[model samples]
Target: MSSRSVIIDNTDAQVQYSPGWQANGSPNEYKRTTSNTETQGASFTLKFVGTSVAVYGTLDIVTLPNTTYVLDGGNPFPFSGQPQSQIQYQQVFYTSPSLPYGEHTLVGSCVDGGGRVILDYFVVEIPLEIPTNTSLSTPTSAVPTTLGSKPTPPTTAIVGGVLGGLLFLMTILVAYLWYRQFRDPGRRRDTKPSFTSAEQDAQTRPFNAPAMASSSYITTQHDAETPNHYSETPRHRDVISTVERHKSPHVSLQWNQSQQPPSYSM
Candidate 1:
């Protein structure tokens, strides 16, 4: 960076004047040089960090005035009086030589003369802020060696992504299970449809049979052998009666003269 100069007003906290010195509001910049008993032995001090510093002031009473500047509490140097015309208002009263690039204290004091001093401001000169380059051929700490390793990402990000993926998968699994549970009962309740009587008559069997012919033959034989005049009441025959009829195939008839033909009416 470049060097620069800054103007610090007398009202800045860094400027410390002895007690009983005049302090008008901060807007104006004059530390009064003379009060009733403050004309002589009056001192103002300021600390700053820079290459050099210069104190500027206005001369209200420079007639036979005596002042001195002390830097870093070192030997004092007297303020040189200006020739011909008395300097006033924002004039450099004393300036320190180019000093070190660190903090230094500058003190201005009115020694003997009763002349008044008005400290307007102080200027501090800062030197260039360039940094020097340093060589580092060796590492201070050991580093690990891997043949082919990918750069590691942040732990928080990787963890978050994994957790998010797992959560999404869990949500899908729950939804799938819930859907199966909702659908399975309806599937189990499914039943085959019932057929009507008319539909059953329209159906066909796989095997062939002569059921109609057999039933018709049996019916014809029973009708021809039966007489209508015979008692039509239903009868139950005993087993003995069937066996006796099977035993007698013929019956011998003994006819006597007394046995006339029985009269029959048809």
Candidate 2:
């Protein structure tokens, strides 16, 4: 009997399987589960070559308790309008009915459409993987620090804050000194004092002397200049002196009223 090769398509299964033991790919074997938890269901594919003389054969599902046969012989599998020759391809789906938690076997036999067995024999087995106990050791060491770790304040900000504080203090001191100097009594000027009773009397005494001197001086000059003219004049010296004194407050004059006043007022 010639050995048949099986290709395990891991791309669809998404699992890693160890290489086959006896036949390179004959019923590829793999550990599905452990003794405690055995795998119940599994699926795989098998390929074979047949000649026109082959017709039918039986594929075996060997479990511990017993063996199950799906199809005893082949049927006329139609391709297009007629049966394919010996070089044709065929596939079959087979699953064991909940086998015992132990080793199992899948035996396949290929045949033509006329109940003729083409393949001599076929066999495949799936195994269970056993895991062992092991320990891992890690080293204690320092780790690299991140940029956000222990962030320090900027140097420029610190310098700017110190300068701002000094500037503010200087401005406050200057303002305080200016306010104290302006409000102090020692720095203010003094105003003149009010007059007393003695000072008032001295100022008024000169007022009376100025008035008397003006009156005598004017009368003596008038009489001496026009003694004869006074007797004939209608207007007397007293009228002229009174009119002159009334012109301004600064002029001091006094006139005797020995003669009668003017005709309009006397």
Candidate 3:
């Protein structure tokens, strides 16, 4: 299990004191084992939940105070103040070995009245909220559920189906158009559009809209006449001149009813 460190001051309520234990010196100097004549039967106990615990205190070098600590009601470990050449505050008096990560009780008592043994503070190593192994459980199921989510719709199939339906509709429309064109011959217009003479002349002659030659709807004042082309009349004699008088160089005359007359000289 992972662990964290904690600092516990001597004045904290977590420390339980017996009758003969009293605050000694300034608060920084810590609590000391005391009595009217003897330091025996004086003790302080603490209950903590952690992996291990260590005790700290201030001690006088002249008369080394004898002390011991009992953990979890088990074997006693020495917490005695040792003789030193110089004065020191907040010194480690006792340290416990690695213990089970759970609640444990610790008791500090005076072993002999050599001098006053001070109790300054405690340092504890505690287990984290979760054990390393417990937090590393399997996460396979949750991952797929989160990333894949609900199964994706069959998008490719749906698009293909829509396209297929449109194609079917287009095929039906084409078939209907084909039937209309072939089944009823009247509906089919194979004959080219007929154009009026004026319209034909306008196209072939490249003329801006030509004037109509005649209006069939208009009434005529005189009856229509049919001319004899081979018969000579007064107008024909005037046009021919006397054949005996002269014969000029002729650019032969020619006429056709449906086509334009050729250029001629008389």
Best by TM-score: 3
CA deviation > 4 Å runs, candidate 3: 27-38, 132-266
CA displacement after TM-score superposition, residue 47 of candidate 2 (Å): 64
lDDT of 2 by residue, 139-222 (tens): 112112221222122367679999999999999999998998888755566566656766987787754424334654666677
Kindly provide the TM-score of model 3 when superposed on the true structure, using C-alpha atoms: 0.44
Model 2 alpha-carbon miss at residue 29, Å: 57
Per-candidate TM-score against the hidden true structure: 0.42, 0.20, 0.44
Model 3's lDDT to the true fold?
Answer: 0.59
Cα-lDDT of candidate 1: 0.57
> Residue 118 deviation, candidate 3, in Å?
0.5
Of 2 and 3, the candidate ranking higher by lDDT: 3
Please identify which of the two predictions, 2 or 3, would achieve the higher TM-score against the true structure: 3
C-alpha lDDT of all candidate models, in order? 0.57, 0.33, 0.59
lDDT of 1 by residue, 114-212 (tens): 565566666776644623342222111212222122212236767899999999999999999899988775457536665775477557534343223
Q: Which residue segments of model 1 deviate by more than 4 Å?
A: 24-38, 61-64, 83-87, 130-266
